[model samples]
Target: MAGLRARLKKTIVLVGMMGAGKTAVGKALAARLAVPFLDSDREIVKAASATIAEIFVRDGEAFFRDRETEVITRLLNAQASVLSTGGGAFLAAHNRQVISDAGVAVWLQADLDLLWSRVRHKNTRPLLRTANPRETLAELYKTRDPLYALADLRVSCGADYSIDDMATAVLEVLKSRPDVLEISRDG
Candidate 1:
């Protein structure tokens, strides 16, 4: 793991649906690799002095997305770390390109049922504030899965996996991508 940490060559960006454990797994991954953990949503909220739900309500999604891109670009340029992005961030072509250029995007793929189980009670999700949130999430899952498939790598997420387990899974995937994460023999 220390060899993996010392040899990391690019940022590992986590992309997937809302309940895919990006934030949780990202934190663990960063810790295990001795790198920083950055959440684009948290960066946006910090910069705007508001929550994501408030940003969506006030500035609208387009505005927030623009800011998201800016933050992503800024963070990716700073250092190689684990970045957990908003569910919609990877859907943008420009964002995808930038991420591909600067880091490796890893989709934390989760099934609809598991996603729903994890996110159904989370009122913080702006997009799920509709009258029929389950239907909304289902529609989103259907629409976004194809785009999320464009990631550089993917790790299937299951209900049985803990945060550490998911992080370890992502780390294993990263190890397979020598261009993104290098494992030194000496460590």
Candidate 2:
């Protein structure tokens, strides 16, 4: 019973850049797996009673990142659930460690052009407050790409991919690695 419970506590954390559909895919994956979905960004917003944009505008990027790290820490220690993190969440060493120690981490990879197209008009993204949104995204990708690559699995999520398709792909990945996940494909 202890072994069964331990296996059941394993979580799947989605790590990727902004506009990579982490939240969308996380929700679908959670539903497919019959687990709850928790977005760290959403959790932070709720905890602070403020939007992410407000946190960034008033507290600055570093401050917002600190809040994100705190939120991720709490969620990582929680029981079975799908966690969707912010774009820069994995960039922090401690944040990456928490994900690594907790459960399987999946990186949803998207190209810079696709990311810019998706986030260009979004005023809520503090990172995109730049003279050239494309350049800012490119720079962010360049720096964070390697960090995201540290995930246990990397899924190619193109610009127009559906949430269902992404969830299916993640399920397939888990199915292929049943030994690590302790989830039988038949189950």
Candidate 3:
């Protein structure tokens, strides 16, 4: 893994739904790769001095999304590491273009049921604060899966997979992309 860390040339951008374990698996993946772990949402919160939910309410989704793009672009340009993006961040064409140009986007694919199970109890998700949150999640799953498919690579997440397991899966996927990650045979 140390050799793998040395060979990493691009940032691994995790793009997926809120409950897709981007943050959790990203942290583990970064640890495994011995690189920094950055979250776009966390950066946004830091810059705004408010939570994502508050940002959406105070500034509006469009405003929040603009900030998200700026943060992502800045982070991707800085260093090679693992970056977890907000669910809707990849939906924007400009954001996708920037991510493709600067890093490798890896979609953490999970089914609606699995996503719902993971995020149902979370109050931090601003988009899931609807009257029918499950249905809303399903709708988001339907609409966003196609855009997510545009990612450079995809790693499926299952109910049986732990965070570390998912991180390993992402690492395996990264191994296939030589431009993004290179694995030394002597390691």
Clash count per candidate: 0, 0, 0
* Residues 1-187 of candidate 3: C-alpha lDDT, one tens digit per residue: 5433436799999999989999999999888877999999999999999999999999999999999999999999998999999999999999999999999999999998999999999899889999999999999999999999999999999999999899989988888888988777553
Ranking by lDDT: 1, 3, 2
Model 1 C-alpha lDDT per residue in residues 117-140, reported as the tens digit of each score: 999988999999999999999999
Over 4 Å off, model 3? 1-6
What TM-score does model 1 achieve against the real structure?
A: 0.96
Model 1 scores worst on lDDT over the 10 consecutive residues at 1-10
In order, candidate lDDTs are 0.94, 0.82, 0.93
Q: What's the TM-score of every candidate structure?
A: 0.96, 0.89, 0.96
CA RMSD of each candidate after superposition: 1.4, 4.1, 1.5
lDDT of 1 at 41: 97
Better of 1 and 3 by lDDT: 1
Index of the highest-lDDT prediction: 1
lDDT per residue as tens, model 2, 67-89: 89888888878877898998988
Comparison by lDDT, 2 against 3, better one: 3
